[model samples]
Target: MAGYVCPVGSSSPHARSNACPPGTFSNHLHLFDKSQCETCPARFVCTRGTGGKQKPPVPCPVGHYCPPGTKYPAQYKCAPGTWSNRTSLASEEECLPCPAGWFCVAGAHVPSGRCSPGHYCPDGTRTSTQFPCPAGTYSTRLGNGRVEDCIACPVGSYCTDGTSKPTLCPVGTYRKEQGAKVSEDCVPCPGGYHCPELGTVAPQACGAGRFSDPGSASCLSCLVGHYCADEITSREAMLLAMVCPAGLLCPEGQAVAPDANGNACPRGYYCPRGDIVRGSVWLLLFTILSSSGLCFWEARVESVLLLESLPALGCLIFLLWFP
Candidate 1:
């Protein structure tokens, strides 16, 4: 009696052979030569054997996946941040974390997507690209591609001309009075004190006294006993006032007044004894009253008497004799 061949897909196949392929086997019930089959259809695997004839088809092994475009079984690799395509995969692995201040767009894939350094994307905006920090804003903090925030300069500070942030204009330092062209145009401080002007130079002395140094914008107080009376004039009053003649004194009893010339008594009325204290005012009045020469002779004689006796009585006598 002849034995019936099993189906080709079952464990017990129709044909059998001792010379099976490395990845295939044969069964006992044979209707045709197993070595003659060159290829297997879908859902089956055929192994190479002697002389290009492949082994009989067998079901694919479990836990292995063959996606399109892959030629070899060893080319299979799991993607980052994703699960492997195998049911028997025991452990889940994650991709590397993105570096600080940087953002990763593609996870665990070779040639991963990334954002440029020193840039960020704001909320509601796509994070595929990086945007640079705008003028008037700055940040020292680390960030990813998602950072869109930057710090602003405070009041009294400005970063004109597209600076990263505002810088301070120091105290006592002021900008140019008008028509400043650039930060350098801010003038050096006036005389007495110093400060950084327009973000340069440390503070320094401007000049002496409230009078500012020449060509400077700042000022200082006058030195003791010396006065800066006006924007242009110097208050050297004592020096400017007239010096009395060798023996003459001013009629006001003071050696000096606004004028430098001593206040000598008038011609008709002499300064009694040439004493400024006893007869200055009277002599001034008498000199005006006796302008007609009426008291000229008596004024001379009274002047002689005053020189001998410079008392108030002599001054009264001189006043009485006035013409």
Candidate 2:
């Protein structure tokens, strides 16, 4: 019998063709009987042969299952959001769920890329990119595992929704607070000062002859005889403006800081906008006359004596007016 065989040293009869069972196979061309068939090995799936010599069972692949007797892998693939990095998996339990800060698509052997910049991913994520960082925060690096990892917008900067990094507050504006969610959080430059560049933490004081108002980007120069004093604005109470010596004429920041705010007007002159200029005659007269503490008539007499020391008023006035 071509398709039949019996145990060795058997009796005269009882030989018949019997197929190998499912999940079992044999490749022996000359053998005794069904007892010679081999059971499928671990980490592999097997199917019965065509009642003849048979091939080896299929080995399991990474991220897939290969239970004994399994005819196809479709029934035991790693699900979406789960993955495996090793082969020879015997069951669905061998695949693990994606880890924090990473993602795994269907049948994934390793995590897809890490969470993208400007985004975050929690455990078992299937699409890490779909999760964005919250507003008022930003992420400059990849694989942020939680929302708390995103950085707050720094002083002089702002962050919108899903930002990758904070943006500098625009020029002529400043922000005192951190974690600004919008551009409007930056305040305009204040009066008596200017904001020359982006991300100004504080306004720069205007120099001589220049004045600014609230929300001004830069200082404006005044006309002749019209001095621009920070004192004319909200700084009137007392401005800590800097001024070089009357004739010393030093550059900014090099002016000797006689006081905390830098130099004040030198003797015999006043600095209207923190710059030296000749003192006003009327102002000098007023200071002497008002502060002498003398009676009205006494002050008037003192003023006349001071005036008498000068040249004749008529001729002096003629030259000044004509010139």
Tell me, by TM-score, which candidate is best: 2
What does candidate 2's lDDT look like per residue over 273-296, in tens digits? 333232322221221233343321
Candidate 1 Cα outliers beyond 4 Å, as residue runs? 1-102, 105-119, 123-129, 144-148, 155-194, 197-323
By lDDT, the best candidate is 2
At residue 298, give the lDDT of candidate 2.
Answer: 12
Q: Which regions in candidate 2 have their CA more than 4 angstroms from the true location?
A: 1-60, 65-77, 86-94, 213-215, 223-226, 231-323
Following a full C-alpha superposition, what root-mean-square deviation does model 1 have from the true structure? 21.5
Against the reference, the lDDT scores of all candidates come to 0.35, 0.60
What TM-score would each prediction reach against the true structure?
0.26, 0.50
Residues forming the 10-long window of minimal summed lDDT in candidate 1: 307-316
Residue 84, candidate 1: Cα error in Å is 13
The per-residue C-alpha lDDT of model 2 at residue 110 equals 90
How high is the lDDT of residue 211 in model 1? 40
